[model samples]
Target: MLKPHQAKQAHGDSPNPVLSINQMNLVYNSTRGPITAIRDLTFSIRKGEFVSILGPSGCGKSTLLKIVSGLLRPTSGNVVLADVEVKEPRPDIGIVFQQPTLLPWKTVLENVLVPIRAMRMPVHEYKDRAHDLLRLVGLGDFINHYPYELSGGMQQRVGIARGLIHDPAMLLMDEPFAALDAMSREFMMDELQQIWMTTGKSVLFITHSIPEAVYLSDRVLTLSPRPGRVIDDIKIDLPRVRDVETMGQSMFGEYATHLRALFKSNTAPSTRIA
Candidate 1:
């Protein structure tokens, strides 16, 4: 693991990244004083690449996601998407939170179309697209089902479909499967990889699970304890179409082991590894 000073700017030399975070910093003014959540953070996500950000809890992992989605502005630095600076929420970006947050009253299909309705896009035009996305996520038959009728994993699949409804340039997922059971989480991992492969969209996934990150990412970026900054940028050379069997392979374990060591070495004493 590289020390803060030794950590190079992640993907600094990669050409044509779909999303770029340049020397980002975010501070929150509270009753106590100003708190810096992120410091000098820099990284890039290439087009159609699946990248994961791994760090201890409260290391600003989700905060970084919010900034990327333009929900929150950094105190300093910039988030550039496809050469355009993200100043406010843009219609072209999609976000999936830890919770599906699906509307209870709406059917799965209706929930998937919420973004389109909010953006004032022609609802009729996207109805077919929504059905296609649901089918892609393996929820074709559940399109008319309410959130209450689905399992936790099924609800999350709905969220994934909703995020892609607009065909955003990239997907920003903040631990989208964190709430699922162990079995469900594992299932979603494989499902998500298939979805990523099919869609060919850039993804910046945030998570605390080392195995999850290692299993899903083309590259994994580790951040330091609070006041988060990149500590290491690791490339996962494991072949794609990884399944449950792939997780048992030596290379997969090696990658997970290496990432676990990075957290142990670079994080503070209070930091907890998932």
Candidate 2:
């Protein structure tokens, strides 16, 4: 459990927050009685910022995202988005999970249009928008293809395109590139950076890979194990333009080695955000 005082430390005296979670505690009351999923967890993310949450398994990372998305209510605490209390799912937030849950029957264009359709907006308005997004994700040529015809990375691109269709204020991704091979993952990271640079929306991305987190984020937030708490929030000092080759540089390797040692301490589940 996190100390009560530390739970809200990140929220105090900062610039106005775009997203705020205050003293959040999540508990599951199951047949086994009650289990604490996360206790006294808290943080705030600013608008147009790319923040990555990194932690070991069972840290309630997904649970925290769910809470922020209004898919789950905290047992105790508050999640405020854009100064509005997030009691229900707001369409302004986009989410992409590890798996691309694209409807098999829908073509790539149609899949990307799902969110737009849900908005009940005029098809003509979003049709070109969808095409532009597909192109942005490098899937313009495959718009008519089905999910089965696409590779894992391609499918994930479709998922990301779909998420962007509505032009959400923030994107919440849960290991969006974890399923891809190394090369594919690298490409996806570049694609994500491209999209982020262009859109400049707030992003809360969750990942288990240090390199991926470091490569894609403006800041990487490391969480401690079960009933997770923010242990450290490190800024990536690496240049905005980076790649696998960046790992060989002193600046990149310094941070990577420091983070590696933190995670390898063995006694503690340490993490890094840079």
Candidate 3:
């Protein structure tokens, strides 16, 4: 476990940081009053690092991702990606949501290329990259298939392919596999690990699952309940190329247990955000 100051120092010492959140805060002006979704959040993701944000529901995990992705502006603080302050949505950030959110009418290939089309960056130029990304996500054979024809996992793979097609500097994933059944979720976890290893993209994953965070992240940043703030920065020392077998190891269980305990100790009554 690293203290907040130590974590900041460690991140500062890194040769290259892909993303940095400095004293971030977000407050929503609801009719009732001002609600703080996040408060004084600070962290950084080094280039090629896979980091996960873990917290109880309504702790603003997804909200944090939005701020980082430039979808939402924070009331205070800053989100810097590659030394550029994010004011609006930029091409350098790619986001994967909890659901695949695929266009039913589009073929898998066409859906994967949506980003390219939306960015108006010469659809033809990204066609090859789309195909390669589909292959990378194990959807090469399903390129012509529609979203309806694929399983939940397959649809999510299409979502991953779409996120990567643009070749962004970092990927922001908001519980991308939370909807899958247990067996499918477990399988997709390994699949995601392979994708991250292959692409080496800086990833900021938001999740509620301790094991999932432990399995996929180089470091896990745990947040306190709503009005979210970083409470712990845990470095996972486990060897990479992790698999189903890796989950059975003592260190794996220890990391998961430690995170679970942290959450338990930090548990508090939080207002539900609709």
Candidate 4:
């Protein structure tokens, strides 16, 4: 395994990226004085690429996501999306968090239409799109069902549908499947890959699971422990259309092993939660 400081560096920004995170740093003033969450972090997500982030807990994975989503600003550096600097929440991007955050009273279709309504677009025009997204996520038969009627996995399916309703330029997922049981998490990984294959939207996924990240992403970016920096930008060369069976392959284990080693060597106190 490469040491944290010696891991492969990110490539240059030649081909235009859909999202560019340039040497980002974030610091907070607290009772303990100044705390740095990220340091000199830099990366780029090309059009239609699926990239996953892995690091120790409190390593600013979610913080980086928020910066890219325009919900939070970085203390230094900048995030540029589609040639425009992201200064505020963008209408062209969608975010799915660990929690589905669905409204219990609303039906699945209604929840999927939330973005459309929030954007002040005619809800009627997006009704068909909502139904199609639900179907794509394998919830066609449950459109009218309420969140209370669904299981944890099903509700997350609804969340995925909701995120895609706007036909956004990029999808930002912050461990969207972290709450599910093992079987369901694996199941959702497959579903997400299929959805990505069909839509070809750029994705920036944050997760602690090495296997999950390696299985779903075209590349995986491993960050150092807090004051996070990109230590490794390893490419996943696995064949597309992967399924659960793909996990049985040697290369799959190789990729997962490499990530685990990076974490073990990168973080001080020498521990990884997942």
Candidate 5:
């Protein structure tokens, strides 16, 4: 378990928080007994910030996102997004999961419009926005293509476009690149960073990769093992518009090394973030 005091000491004061999780806790009712998935996990994401949550599998990383997305209710505490308490799903929020989850029958452009349709928004109004987002994700030429016709990376790009179709203020990404090959994963990281930079959307990304978290995040939140707690909140001071070359720099290695050390000390090596 992480010592909250150490976490607070490491991150002396938080910036203006766009989302706040205060003393959050979650307990699962199992056949055996109650299982605590999270205990007093507290943190915040500031406006237009790219924050990554790093932790082991089954560490309530996804659970935390669910709560933040208003898909699930925490046993205690609350999640406030943009000063609005997230009691239920909100139209301004978007999510992209590990899998693309695109409708195979739907064209890339059609997939992007799913959210707008579900929200009962004027499809005509968001049609141009959808096309613009697809272009932003480098899928303009493939808008007519179906999911089956696209590569894994391209499909994930469609997922991202769909997430942004509604012009959401905040995006919740749950390991969106975890399913890709290492090369593709790295490529998607670059694309994602560029997209985030271009869109300026506040993002809360959940990932198990230490390097990915360090490379893509403005701040990395390290969580302890099961019954997760915030162990460390380290700010990445690297320059923006980071490219593959940035990965080879000394500072990148230092951040990766520091996070590796934290995982080794706080959680099992087998489930290390990297």
Candidate 6:
């Protein structure tokens, strides 16, 4: 495993990133006391890069996503996006949570169109695009169906489509398939890869599954427990093109085992209950 400082020295000095964080720190102020979830962390993700952050439950992985999406601010550091500081929620960033969080009454097409409508963009311009996104997620025949009519996976499909509607520069996803069955979770992984390949979008995906992270990301960032900081940032050496067959290969198993052990032996306390 590469050391944290070495990883930073190698990947941090370069500059082709869509977003960059330098000496980042995040502390939650509560009535009890000040809690530091993340501390002096630093990393970068280049354009079109797929980065996965995996760690134990209280490692502040989701908290880091909040910072990147501009939903929360770092206490003493900066989050720079496309040469600008993210002071507040901007339309250019799209976020998807663990649950689908879709509007139950709206049909799939309507849900997908909400982002475009919220941005006050011409609806006509995205009508076909919306259909195209629905189709891309294998939901072409379900466009008019209401959220209640669809399965957990299908609703998530709609959520994915909605996130991409605005053509955000970056996508932040937090355990979006954690609530699904194992089979559905694997299916969602494939769907996400397809979308990422087609859109070439920069993505920061958070998950606790080592194989999932190793399979999906170009690079994986592992953090310590509370006051989480980089513990390991290893490149998945398996090939550029990943699929079921890739999972069977020895290299894939090696990487997965490596990551699994890294997390197992890691002892980071929870700053906040998840």
The lDDT values for all models are: 0.90, 0.82, 0.88, 0.88, 0.88, 0.84
Q: Give the higher-lDDT candidate: 2 or 6.
A: 6
Provide C-alpha RMSD values for all models, in order: 3.1, 5.0, 2.9, 2.7, 3.6, 2.9
TM-score of each: 0.94, 0.90, 0.94, 0.94, 0.93, 0.92
Model 2 steric clash total: 1
lDDT tens string, model 3, 1-274?
Answer: 4333433322432456788888999999999999999999988889999999999998999889888888899999999999999999999999999999999999999999999989989998898998899998888899899999999999999999999988999999999999999998998999999999999999999999999999998988899888999878878888889988889998788778777877877783353334
Candidate 1 wrongly placed segments (more than 4 Å) = 1-10, 270-274
Question: Which ranges in model 6 have alpha carbons more than 4 Å from their true place?
Answer: 1-10, 268-274
Expressed as tens digits, the lDDT of each residue in 159-198 for candidate 5 is 9999999988799999999999999899999999999999
Once fitted onto the true fold, the runs of candidate 2 whose alpha carbons sit more than 4 angstroms away are 1-13, 266-274
List runs of model 5 lying over 4 Å from the truth.
Answer: 1-13, 269-274
User: What are the clashing pairs of model 4?
Assistant: none
Q: Looking at model 4, which ten-residue stretch has the lowest summed lDDT?
A: 1-10
| Sort by lDDT, top down from the best | 1, 5, 3, 4, 6, 2
The clash count for each model shown is 0, 1, 0, 0, 0, 1
* Comparison by lDDT, 1 against 4, better one: 1
- Clashing residue pairs in candidate 5 are none
Model 1: per-residue Cα lDDT at residue 241 = 87
Higher-ranked by lDDT: 1 or 5:
1
Worst 10 residues of 1 by lDDT: 1-10
lDDT of 4 at 93: 95
Error of 2 at 60 (Å): 0.5
lDDT of 6: 0.84
Q: How many clashes does the backbone of model 3 have?
A: 0
